[model samples]
Target: MLSMKVLFAHLGREHLGVEYLSAALKRQGHETALALDPGLFGINDNVFHNARLERRFDQTRRVLRALEEQRPDLAAFTVYTSTFPWALRMAREFKRRSPRTPIVFGGLHPTFEPERTLRCRDADFIIRGEGEGALCDLAHALEHGTDPREIPNLGFRADDDSPALNPLRPLIGNLDDLPFPDKGLFERDINFRDDYIVLCSRGCPHRCSYCCENALHRLHGPGWYRRRSAESVLLELEEMKARYRFREVMFNDPILLTHRGWLEELLEGYRRRIRVPFRCFGQPALMTDAMALLLKHSGCQCVEFGMQTVNEDLKRETLGRPETNEQALNAFRICDRHGLPFDIDHMFGLPGECAADHARALDFYKPLRRLNRIKTHQLVYFPGTAITAEAAE
Candidate 1:
């Protein structure tokens, strides 16, 4: 059997999805490499850019250069909405250079907008949702010269040059069965000394209108939200600590406090074995005295909460966030009492937002004693999110 060398192209920060897919492919006896483009000049990850500087330093050229050097059998990319265009540009250039080599795209953007993404002539195939299994299958089929279009969760252009999408495969029930992410892929690019990021869970519980989680939940059904076993998570962290000697750990789960029983068990193990200082996100409505205390005792340096709006009516009706303004305050108060530094994620410019909303947010946050920082962002309407449909209406 041919051992396909799969090249994954990514921009800016290290991507956990790409790492996981690479690990899966390697486990199946396929080789993988990363062509990381440090997206400079406001390409995708960073905010700093000068038009002149950007023109002088087209970072995609660097990625293309890597492509020429590696000349892998397949090129893959994991993309989000913000980085879709960049991914396309890179794909088109790769097609231009090596038309015979196939390109596959996966991740949040393609998971939702598979057809639109495949409309690009250069995009040979896309794997939508939970790609580790599907990608490995696709690679195996491709290496053995088998037809790949029937593979679940894969999308490709039909003989008529139209998008042909296969139904999604069943979601992976136990994340522990999968091998640990291929962190070696990004060792040279990422500063593991600062913080080692780990995703201990898959999918978010809440169906927030602005987020794609709801769409995912709709697609995958009730089991959409799943967490890694506490033992699995601690073992990964223990391995990471031994390898990188990381000063800090970052839980990149959508919300770290999904299951109380799991959280308590994880915290207990974390405190005892992997006691490195860490930070994670939690829903304000999910916070409790016991949970906050456990986090503090477990070496959590901070907790971040999404307090998108102070107006309860807008939050529920528009954002679909079940948490009320009082609940958010209670969460803050609980954190403060436990001496847990916390940050507030603030979003302005909702569809029907006004200056009063901003003022009210300011008033709500002004009195919080343990508020580490208020991270502000303008709301972005992704293509298939409920908020985008409502905004159009």
Candidate 2:
């Protein structure tokens, strides 16, 4: 097989995943480079809270120029829902400069809406779901004149009248097989002091109406919520700690403490071995005072609970979260007692949520505010989410 030069563009968080994939490709005897968009750096909560868009077109252009100079055979990009438009524009620009370079799109947006993404002239291919294996396959295919159609989980347009989607591949159950994301790719560009993120697992089991994870589950099958073993996760963490030396780590899993047994094992392992302060997302119902205390002892400095709203009727009937205000408040109190900083996640503009409901959420958050940080955000109606479908109807 011919060696290929590959460039991966990550427009969001510069974490282990991007680095891991790049390293894996390199290990396969391919040259790899990474371009991380500025937005992925930790958001300025102040500016973000104010809903300000700080567009650094010049910086992006400079990065694009550098990538163009590399003249990679293939350019792959991972785009989030909010950053899709900008990512599309960047892909277009990349294609304009290196028209021969195959530009492929992936991530949550492409996984769910491949047809829509294929419509963009710049994006020659879209890979859905877990991309480590698929990306390597795509790179090799392009380098050796292999057929793109045979690549699993890919979407492209055919000469016929319609877009073609390869058969969806099964989710990677043995996460241990995938190599840890390569941090060396961003060692010079990213500073863990300001930004740090990781993902121990993918997909969420909960079917919250407003959540997009459920949609991701439906995209493939019910078994989308897969995770790496505790040993596997710790290995990655050990490598990250030894290399990057991050003071803090943020697990971006929708719900890090989802599986009680797995979470306990993970926490215990971290406590015994690597004990860097960390934070993660959680649900109130799943978190007991004992678990919260264990997490704190295991170096968990913070936890962000998805309180969503306090309107009981709307919480249950509208968003399908079914979390009681008292339950959430207790969780916050537990975190406080354990001296773990916590953030209450609230969403605005839900279906049937009104000014009164917003007021109710504020009232509910009042008591918890003293215990922890409270955050409120406008509901982003993403494509393929239940709330989005409900809103359309």
Candidate 3:
């Protein structure tokens, strides 16, 4: 394939998605540059000529100027619902200045909701599902002048009415084949001096109605969950610990501690090789005494539970998460018994959630002392989740 330069624009939080794509592109001999938004980190004072917003505007101008100078063939964007407006705004501005450039949007927003995304004027193509390989395909196609219509996991604006969405690509079964994200690329805009983030796995296996993972997995076809080797994970941690000297590391995986054997091997490897106190995600049902002890021994300082609600009936009939309240409580108790700090998760503002449900949550929280933090996120209706249809009703 002909060599080409591609630039990635994103808002915040380590820039892992684009960094993986960057590594993939570089692995195939393409040039990649990251143009992260400084506005993402800026606070909003919520007033006219807000200094935070003004500073962000200035950063946007700098980005535009840099892109103009660099003149990359394609400007790929990692977008989310929160970052969509700004991503498109910058994309359109850059397109106005250099109309020949193609703008591709990826990530949770674009992946499941392609039609809504394509309606955005600047969204030229979307690489849905796991973008590492599909992004590489897009870059290669663009570099070699190949027809992009049939590229797997690609959605393109066509000449006719309906947008062209190619067949879904096969999911990456063994995630170890993918390159470790180039942390150096994101270190341009972030300093993880205290926090090291990792993704030892991809795709949560549960089909929680409100979660994007369900739709995302359907988009990937089947066998949605995949994990890297404990050795691979440990090696990456070893390097990051030595290089950044971070005080804490956090697993960004949706649900880690997938199984007893995998968790044991990882815990053993971590204890033997690395010890930078880390945190990870765990499901309430999967949380067990054995796993908690393994986590404690492995320097797992915290475990965040994704228990969307404490109401068992609502969870089963409405949320598609069937774990009992006792299951969740037992999970937390195991961690507490092991002296591992924990975070309890809950979702407020579901379709039928009421004052009683909230009071139930407060009552449930009263006895859970191991709780380092409690995260109560209001339900957001992303376009394609199973909860979306119910939410509309």
As a whole number from 0 to 100, the lDDT of residue 257 in candidate 3 is 71
lDDT for each of the candidates? Answer: 0.88, 0.78, 0.81
lDDT by residue for model 3 (1-393), tens: 478899887665576777778888888998888776656334322123356655656578777877898889889998877678888899999999999998899888887778888877687898777888788888888888887778888998888856778877777778788777888877766778778888888778788888888877766655887888888898888887788887888888888878678878888888888776888888888888888888887888888988777677888998898889888888988877878889888888877768888888888888877889887677778767888967677
Positional deviation of residue 274's Cα in model 3 after best superposition, in angstroms: 1.2
Provide the lowest-lDDT 10-residue window in model 3.
40-49
- For TM-score, the strongest prediction is 1
Error of 1 at 167 (Å): 1.1
Superposed by TM-score, candidate 1 places the C-alpha of residue 254 at a distance from the truth, in angstroms, of: 1.5
Number of the predicted model whose lDDT against the real structure is largest: 1
For model 1, how does the per-residue alpha-carbon lDDT over 1-393 read when each residue is reduced to its tens digit? 569999999977888888899999999899999898777676463467577776666677779999978999899999889989889989988888999999999988998898899887667899988898888888888899999988999999999989999998899999999899999999988888789999898888789999888878877889988888989989998998899989999999889987789888998998899878999999988899999988998899999999988878888999999888888899999998888999998897887778998998898888888999998777889877888888789
Candidate 1: C-alpha lDDT: 0.88
Clashing pairs in 2: 12-40, 19-181, 19-182, 20-181, 20-182
Candidate 1 residue 207 C-alpha distance from true site, Å: 0.8
How many clashes show up per model?
0, 5, 0
TM-score (C-alpha, index-matched) for candidate 2: 0.91
Instruction: Give a tens-digit lDDT track for model 2, residues 292-319.
Output: 8878889887788888777888888878
